[model samples]
Target: MLTRKQHELLTFIQTRLESSGISPSFEEMKEALDLKSKSGVHRLISALEERGFIRRLANRARALEVIREPDTASPRTAPRGPAPVKPVAPAPATLREPANDVIEIPLHGRIAAGAPIEAMEGATMLPVPAALLGPGEHYALEVSGDSMIDAGILDGDMALIRRTDVARDGEIVVALVRGEEATLKYLRREKGMVRLDPANAAYDPQFYTPGEVQVQGKLAGLLRRYH
Candidate 1:
């Protein structure tokens, strides 16, 4: 059950939304709850939000909204979690969960060479979506050479690729060819063959027939960490 204070706060929010067709301000919530400051109301609201009762939107002041009514019935019967166990215990033997501390990277589908990037479905990659990388869904690749040193990509660096099937003929990409191989190269279409040009002049440009070269993904961003 809501210890009376929570109930009062929720009721005030519900009422304001019903009356104004919009959410109430934090100050209003404090006034209704007789809180000395808005921070007290803010904490309670955060608690309510945690419990699935509301959500806070970004950048708007009148930002509170009730998502679900609080379940205030039955006085919270689940016995409060065994009192925080005494001391450290050995890990159970059969419970060897491989630590996937490596957050599954979110991956967009691969792009094809010489074509506009297309939406990829059924190809989901797990990634920490919080990385402020550039546009489009993200994928990763092993950097091959240092030609892009001017572009900051180094060999052995993990490039976060974005899915795109088409480009302006000079974008770096992951190209798959009839050789059943994938490589990072600049895509260029000249005459009849699509040219897979390496950024490093030491490596020569590879050519392909009309249907020989396919782009799997384009270079969007890179991640490198020392071993």
Candidate 2:
């Protein structure tokens, strides 16, 4: 079993790897662990490596490969032969794979996967910040009509909208109309009426009945490609 300090260091290292898509450097590990000396953290890592809990690439930065971590259960306390180590747990199928290895189409908006393309409210995918998206913050959007010409956003552009149920008026959002078809438009509610205004003049504003449109998330950011 790892000591408290070792556990904390391991957690930090693992979380850092998951967030940064890379292992923590020695100095980073030392600083995170708040150790008085780099050697102290080094000793813990070396011990873990020797025990086959992790493997490091030679002369590589943040190239740690986790082998296996001990199970949470305590030892049986009987002098049994060498205890077999536990295995790494599998990731849930529902979760998206690393964006670096796979194309994570930002859940900007939901289109009719089977029918006409409509704004998809309640994003099904998200962009993780620790990598490109913020610290524990994520965004999702439904690609709607484009109004941001100067911003380089075009129609069908995947909007990496930051997930926020609450946002300032005028922020582009993935909104649901009576929980039916979703759309992308500036969210504004006034005098018991909701307006889904498009950024492009080519598209006219959409007025909604009272409590007809619901906001899923605000446009925190956007992504697009040139023709």
Candidate 3:
């Protein structure tokens, strides 16, 4: 038997998928379930997957498929008499193929993961899987340092960036400092100062006046190529 939260989550996912082709994000699931953190939603999803009720698609972000639904009908709704059977036809055989959608975005040279570095623009383009992106204008940047290694962003990783001028606190963003250099760090606000924090503890946070920093874009996703 499924738990109450599990049933509600499954129902919500089904409803969302029926209305829209895209699955809801982890933040949406957490909000819908009135949970404190996104970790709670992760645990619930893990439970559902273990029970074979849903499966996650490979190489896709925010992708989920509901394979089965829970049996929630009550015994009181049982029919009184036996129902008549009808002849059923067999379904036709067909081959299912995976989707291969790729989009090319501008590769805007390197951005620092350690210290602020000059952001160079280039004519090159990077082809990314469509499933990794959401609705927004996006671009790509080559990471050049190890300050954000704790956040799983390594040196030489392709950082997918969504172009946006505004971002909420605590989000990873591409911050333009003094309109010359750019760095990937956690955006935070402190006593009248804009603080850019690094994921690695070895580095200290950089603080600047609000006017010194410009919000260029937010971190959307990442693309890593294995050698």
Best by TM-score: 3
Model 1: weakest 10-residue lDDT segment is 82-91
Whole-model Cα lDDT of every candidate shown, in order: 0.57, 0.56, 0.79
1 or 3, greater by lDDT? 3
The alpha-carbon lDDT assigned to residue 189 of candidate 2 equals 80
TM-score of each: 0.44, 0.46, 0.60
Clashes per candidate (backbone, < 3 Å): 18, 11, 0
Which has the greatest lDDT? 3
Error of 3 at 118 (Å): 1.3
lDDT of 2 at 69: 60
Off by over 4 Å in 1: 1-103, 106-129, 146-150
1-227 per-residue lDDT for model 1 (tens digits): 45466667866776766665566665567778888864466557656666666665443445456665544342334365211212222212231212211223444443332232332334454443222233244566555546555456676676677667676689987777764666677889999889887656565678889598777677766667798
User: What TM-score does candidate 1 get on C-alpha atoms?
Assistant: 0.44
Candidates 1 and 2 compared: the better one by lDDT is 1
The collision pairs in model 3 are none
lDDT of candidate model 2 versus the reference: 0.56
RMSD of each: 18.2, 14.3, 13.6
